[model samples]
Target: MTKKDHEESGLSKSVWSDADLEEMGWHDATVHALFLQPGEMASRLLLDLDYPVRWVPPVRRRDPFTFWVAPATLVFEEVWDLEGSLDFKGLAPELELDGIHRLAPPDGRAEYPLWHLEGHAFELKFRASGFRQYFRQAPRHVAGPMLEYADRGGCAFTEVGFD
Candidate 1:
């Protein structure tokens, strides 16, 4: 589905609007986990955006502009193809997201656009009909110093927050 479709369907209107995501680019976002299901039963890819981006706090605090990290999950639906390599041995690696791009489908056979996700440790190219992003929880206010150590361990969802 297109951006308008998602908006009209109220799929991404809860926590993030299109303008919000446009302003807060995916650069430097940490990928804490990746779940890809490619089969007749399910064809989708889910990415845990650990340290997505800095957002203004809803309520003002001592520091007028204290930084916050809003963790979210990005999902690609109706995935027809997926190809990539990720290391999943001892512990799940934290892949620093570089960027996400929408490109023309290869060979013009697919019904949807192609998505290319570039990261510091991995690269993925897939053809998906559409995608959506939703926050895992309220934006967690974090200290400026803590940002440096945010990705030092497993994802907040897997390590602590999520059950």
Candidate 2:
């Protein structure tokens, strides 16, 4: 989505503005972000599938071990510019689900499938505002086995990754 469209969606109007994004020290050009904590069942399934997985050490001093054994699926959500669509290397292919409507009015539900590939990510989900959008994961990370699956191939295991 364009910056204006993302802002016009009113998801984060109070926190940022188009003008504010132009500031010299602006950190990002999108709206909100989410760090998904996977549930037990999902995590177990990945391990059962024998997907390549690893745990990376946490970069932050306060954070717990970078590598962890959890039973849940994890994904990062962030509002970003159009450029995120570019890279797709080393990412796992995903099954794209379509036609899921947003739950909220004005702002609808956002849901879609994402495959992490070669330093990039692919997503096809609807946002909370009822807008159907796709996403590509960007660089920047905390290492872990989950990331190891980023380079996996073939469609057989794609559906297993999502909830």
Candidate 3:
């Protein structure tokens, strides 16, 4: 949430140590990125990269509308962990902008909950400086690395350190 908090909690702390990640069956540089386009457009990005990712239900809300219409946002948090890496820990929930589904596709007049899968694996972590900044302001969207996700899913992850 707050950079100051992350700095203070030692969650974002950097501790340099000698550790071989590659030798332990762990890879970090390979990034599998998924960008869900806006709802105005019709499309879906499905790739057989590495881990099959599940679609987490998006958070939504309703606002006062005088036009007898509603607007909603389809949000998704996909996660992956780097095994045998000593630098990072915990499941990292990467935010994804799933298409906003309306009562009518391509139309924003109708209100509806966004649809997403609960099972899938991602090949890479999403990092957009703008998003980080936005979440920093909101504080509620605070998310760490994919290691947390792996741990939560009962999957094994590793962390390596380089000194």
Give the candidate number with the greatest TM-score: 1
The candidate, 1 or 3, that scores higher on TM-score is 1
Q: List the residue pairs that clash in candidate 1.
A: none
Give the residue spans of candidate 3 off by over 4 A: 1-4, 7-33, 41-148, 152-163
What is the C-alpha lDDT profile of model 1 across 1-163, one tens digit per residue? 2222122212333244333545446777777678876768548787777553464543656564444555667777788667877665675576878788878887885557888888777889988876767654444455531243354334433212211
**After aligning candidate 3 to the native by TM-score, how far in Å is the CA of 28 from where it should be?**
6.6
Best by lDDT: 1
- Residue-pair clashes per candidate: 0, 37, 30
RMSD of 3: 21.3
Q: lDDT per prediction?
A: 0.60, 0.24, 0.21
Ranking by TM-score: 1, 2, 3
lDDT by residue (19-45, candidate 2, tens digit) is 232221211112122233344433111
lDDT for 138 (candidate 1): 43
lDDT accuracy of residue 120 in candidate 2: 18
For model 2, what is the alpha-carbon lDDT of residue 129? Answer: 11
Q: RMSD for each model, in Å, please?
A: 8.2, 16.4, 21.3
